[model samples]
Target: MKKHIIPTIAFALFTTSAYGQSMQVGFSNVTTVVPGGDIKICKARYGTGYVTSPHKNGAKIHKSSDKGHFIHITKSNVTLHHDVYVMANEYNMSYPGDKGEITAKAYVYATALDRKSGFSGVFSDGQCKGQLTISAK
Candidate 1:
């Protein structure tokens, strides 16, 4: 009885450890536009984003459902406020030479994410330049 109990306990512990908790994140009411008049959606379309040093207090902003995603700050290469934290995810844009609207792009899972002091993400031109306007849906 003792031997059987120990084996079962050990197996349960091992299984629980192996299948650890996974992170959950969501980005709704998302909208972004480019200087040329294009939209940028940072949902599952591209992938997860990065939350820079300003937009966070520690390594990451775990509770994002409360504070909205700061898409503008992540694109301007400048701090939104004194300390603008954010998610460093990917997005898509429609560059029709200032004659386009925002639309859902695609989704992807990235390997890692990075934090920065300025804008660095998906854009219409892919250069991180131009007006990458972003707001809640």
Candidate 2:
């Protein structure tokens, strides 16, 4: 009887502690494209990409989500703000002797019941280059 009571209490404590805990969601591939023109740019793949959140801190994509020249995430990346989930990245590329910088951003809305959500944002290189969109596809 004492053993059973102790086990039940332990389980209850564990359950309550795990409630509202941070979590990571992984995706095989998420397409990133330029808006309006619908031009294809890059993709987030390799199966290492994921979005994580800290309980009620909101969703976030860490620096490890980077995929080559396509997207480069940094420690300062904030995928959500004011209850909105916005993912952003920065990458550098070089052509011959010239070097260039690229930045991409996307906002995604998802709930526990949502299997998919609409994602869209902007990409810039130097100037306010262009807008881009993303989708889990």
Clashes (backbone N, CA, C under 3 Å), per candidate, total 25, 1
Q: How many backbone clashes does candidate 1 have?
A: 25
Report the poorest 10 consecutive residues by lDDT, candidate 1. 71-80
Question: Could you list the CA RMSD of all candidates, in the order they appear?
Answer: 17.1, 14.0
Write model 2 residue lDDT over 1-137, tens digit each, in one string: 11112232242233231113322333333333434432233322213334322222232322222222222233223233343444343533321112323343432333221113434444444322433433332
Q: Write the per-residue lDDT of candidate 1 for residues 1-137, one digit (tens) a residue.
A: 11112232242232221012122332333444444433342332323332212224331212121223222111211111233322223333332232334333322222112121122233332322222212211
Error of 2 at 66 (Å): 16
Error of 1 at 25 (Å): 0.8
Q: Which ten residues in a row have the lowest lDDT in candidate 2?
A: 1-10
For model 1, the stretches where C-alpha displacement exceeds 4 angstroms are 1-20, 33-37, 40-137
